[model samples]
Target: MGKLLTLAKEIIFPSRTTCFICGREEIVGEDDLCDACRESIHLCICPPAPLPLDGVSAGLLYTKELHEPMHRFKYRDKVEYAAFFCQYMSIPQDWSIDILCPVPLYYLREMKRTYNQSELLARRISAIYQIPYCRDLLEKTRNTATQTRLNPAQRQRNVQNAFKAAPECKNLSVLLIDDVYTTGATLASCAKELKKQGASKVYALCACKTDN
Candidate 1:
């Protein structure tokens, strides 16, 4: 009877779900992506080039295999993917950041999406590392155009003055979290505001970075 019940459950809920990237049902592990797709993911080997921010760390190189999963994580309602993605983020031992602050979304845009993807990643990191997560420390003062289509220079221009750091950030070291680091423009702008508000140092941690 137990075996029969288990079989019935799998039939009802479809225990074998397709991989997030390749759409293969023969997933080997509990992760959303199958074993073959997981093995194909190319992690970033070398650290990214220096940005305006003090330091930058990223997990994966933006590749064709990562595109669909990231799209589903950010735009689609695949919030559960945060755990899978967070596995790649590795915080440096020497940084000793005081707080984890996810890049904020404007109120209207956040309301439309129902949650900030970065915040989701930050919360997971906070829980894992026992660091305090401060959502209010930095905020998006204005809703700007998406950085998807912009060139590196234009990306900088688009996000200029877009973030406002709270005074409570004074003297605190911060680690900013984001879903992607395309041109480093968004992170640079955020770091600038944090520093202007008296943040001692700001570092960036991103789940993926474009390999330009």
Candidate 2:
């Protein structure tokens, strides 16, 4: 099914093209946090350690007040929110990221949502870094229950084999993007799949984490 859709897209548009916190309604160009919300938005940036996953960084910490905009970006389709990465990303200019990959959603779920939040984030980063953005490189093969509803162990089981890599990402170093990280189950599972497909290395980036 994913393949058929890919074929259809290839027959149609050949190329794929290219966040925000609180009180700031509109994020300025390439900025995740607006000036009015800068101080507080900085308050939401997540630290880079002990997050149950390594080599992943995020721009915000999901809080009660912070959830509104983040949730809007995710469940709704306010993708312009991804620009918030510009405010918080610290990727070295020489980091030499080979590819930009997004955490994938099960095919049916993506259709219903009309877009994958992570994919949109990746595209924005790809544009900024001038790297290759490959959406099809990781495909979600399952549509399990919401990850948020599952316990940690259950979440691990639910996402197993949920992702598979495309040939284009084989032997490439991929920086995977996601919306949030809670237990790291999803990141590990997706990275494992990319590694299985011969990815040289797999790193992760997300907008936020609950415990961060």
Report how far residue 101 has shifted in candidate 2, in Å: 0.6
Clashes of each: 0, 3
- Residue-level lDDT tens digits of model 2 in 131-192: 88888888888777888788888988998888787867787888888888787888888888
Candidate RMSDs in order: 3.6, 12.9
Task: Give the poorly placed runs of model 1, Cα more than 4 Å off.
Answer: 1-17, 46-51
The true-versus-predicted C-alpha distance at residue 27 of model 2, in Å, is 12
lDDT of 1 by residue, 39-138 (tens): 8887775365355588888888888888888999988989988998898898878788999999999999999999999999999999999999999999
List the lowest-lDDT window of 10 residues for candidate 2: 15-24
What is the TM-score of candidate 1? 0.89
**Evaluated with TM-score, which candidate comes out highest?**
1
Q: lDDT per prediction? A: 0.88, 0.72
